[model samples]
Target: MKSKSFKRYFILLYPFLMLITLVLVALISNISLNDILMAAAKPLTSPFYRLSFIKEFLIVGLLSVAMNLSLSMGEMNFSLEGIFHMAVFLSALVAIYFANFFIIIVLVPIVLYFLWQVPKKVSRGDGNKLIISSLIFNYLILGAINYLVYTFFSDENISSAVTKDFAFALDMKLGVAIAVASLVAFIIFAVKTSLVTKLKIIKDAPSILTSTGTEIKKEKRAIDLCLTLLTSVAAFLYLFLNYNRFSLQSFTGYGFDAITVTLLARGDFKKLAYPAILITYIRLLSLVMQTEFSFVSSVMYLMQGVLIFISILEARDDRNY
Candidate 1:
């Protein structure tokens, strides 16, 4: 029974599947698999590098899990992009003045609690309304953030159109520890607890979930609110490691990789880690290939576009069949 439940959690051998796909991609490009693995293994080969990779993976994994919270509930909270940047911008403003703990305890949560309303306001109805409203509210938040930053901090050197170093930031180690903790908490909440069963109802039988008077809508918003808080906290911590301050640019365009990772994982939390690593590697490879490998970034993106188009075609065919 335990083994069966474990299999259900992990689904197929995802780690092996990722490795095989990676090796095939390497061989097709005529690159030595050893070299590719070695490059990816810099984290293991070097301790400092390992921390960087761990931090990176934890960020990706956390974002994926956060999105899964809402996506599993048949919702997509795009305001996460806004929430992330707003917290990032807000972090710099507050962290520059206060101690690290004060920033984390007071400023971070306060910003998150307010920005949490954006998703609640935007994601009113499901389907296109959800997507469009999310995008709309996301921009609205970005605009407000931009105005506040410009109006208040326009003359301040600590946080303006330029980036500046600051004191009282989370060290990479502590940031990574907190990120791991967040991911673990999310895993327990999503997987080990009964929330998964409720989420399944939302995903597979929304009508039933609604009919049961389960207050699932309230639950869904609460979960999204929690996720927004988590992602914002991590974003604030990331400011300490790098990018202490910057202009109020949109982070909405970011985390597109999370979507890819979540889709590949298919809501299997245990399957999430391997794909997160793979997508992160793909992201890094896209950067690395820009300079050395024969495949330039444009060519890589073109190939990706082609593959995505074919996948869409295949999906359409399956649906029609």
Candidate 2:
């Protein structure tokens, strides 16, 4: 019975199976017998590469969960771009002054609260309206954030847009530990808790997302706020892990990847982690393939799009709606 129950949920693992298929394709795209042998021995030869993969996955996973919460309500958030920059800058600023990780953590919720209010005011109770408003609002906020980063973070030590690292939260060991704990705890709470049912109900009936006044209450509001804060935290954590330098660019590049991870998860929070890992592999593979096999790398993203679409289709459940 236990094995049967477990097997029933095996379909949820489709993202990973797709990921395996992808890995094979990538390896074959520019195949070499020696490279195949190296790939087989990679784990034994260089275990840190595996660690690097896990670290990237956790970073992507946190941001995906943040998006998943809002997506469950049938809403799209583009504020992730601004959130990534602001969370890192503000958190790094606090770290430089106080040298306390807790301070950075505490400040995230406040920053997110302000960000969360932006959409509520701009959106006219419509999902598409919210997306447009978010794009406008986030870029507006991004301008201010870029200016601040360039002015404050870009000093004499930093000739370009990047800068030196800050301590406290910048430790790789600490970041990895936090990532593991976060992945485990988030999965447990999202799947094993009562909130799972509420999320499922919302996923099945996306209409209720905009049915304002009496149709919604603290339940949905609480989840949205939690997601907003989670997105900010994900940004904060990224800065912690890769605090080597700051990017003053309008976008930090992970916003789309985060969205891809969330969409691939397809409302099943339990399966969210796998999609995050899959995206991480695709991204990392693209980086390697870009230099060695430019043509193959160019097609990597298109391949990922096809796979994510198929995986999401498999996970789609349209019963209640």
Candidate 3:
């Protein structure tokens, strides 16, 4: 009986053992275990550490949840990336031209609403159509940004270059205001989910609840929005806090990092916060590793990509026949 019990325990432990072995092999072959642990721990207290990655992670996670929710309802809309980039550009432009902190607080949701609504209406409930339309819209926004920057601020100093001074201003009061507003918005949404319609929707479609119509969904969305707003504010604030602020440059890599963290967390915003920090740490460590052990950094990215791919495949297989 004891032997049988031991065998059963071993069966249960098998997958964990495999995972540990894989991690050990990877570390032994490429990076030192100590270095990897240190790299992972660096985010906890990095001088450049900003809580904004948490916000970014939440935003991306919420967006992912929203997309999943819509898809479960038989609606396919993948225009979030486009909407997100557009929102960022528009917010930055607002900060540059008007410098009204409240404007961002008011405008972001409006922009997201329109971004969400247009394709939904045009597609008329066709998932594939909605996706294609969103893709086109994303390209259009990218083109517009290029044209606008080229036309109005074509001079190298004015156009392509970021004004160090202005960047600093964004990081200070303006950043703080954005963070506060985002937090408020998140709280309101979370409180409002107690309404009957949302509960009914959750009852009818549990999966949709996972994405949109549950108490948790509302909480998650609110958290994500708050996190994103805070991140944006913090990033801008960092510029102001430092006198050596550079030009207003978009960090697409950070955006992609947020997406990766969100994907890794599977849209659980609360759970995602810590992982987002880890991701940020990894990003910083990558810089150091790139200089010391170039190939390892590349391998880390490759491994992350593989993990994401495998996750998607497994999720799809589980969901479908």
lDDT for each candidate structure: 0.60, 0.62, 0.49
Give the per-residue lDDT of model 1 (tens digit) for 91-144. 777665554556565667566766665555655553445656765776787788
TM-score of 3: 0.57
- Weakest 10 consecutive residues of candidate 3 by summed lDDT: 163-172
lDDT of 2 by residue, 270-310 (tens): 66766676667665554444444452433444554564444
Question: Native-vs-model 1 lDDT?
Answer: 0.60
lDDT of 3 at 174: 53
C-alpha RMSD for every candidate: 6.5, 6.3, 8.1
Pairs in steric clash, model 2: none
Candidates sorted by lDDT, descending order?
A: 2, 1, 3
- The reply for model 3, stretches above 4 Å from the true place, is 1-46, 49-78, 119-123, 126-140, 158-181, 195-250, 287-320
The candidate scoring highest on TM-score is 2
The list of candidate 1 runs beyond 4 A from truth reads 1-49, 106-110, 113-123, 139-161, 188-193, 242-254, 287-321
Best to worst by TM-score, what's the order?
2, 1, 3
Residue lDDT tens for model 3, 98-191: 7776887677655666556677678875545665676567567656755665555334654464431233243434545655565566456646
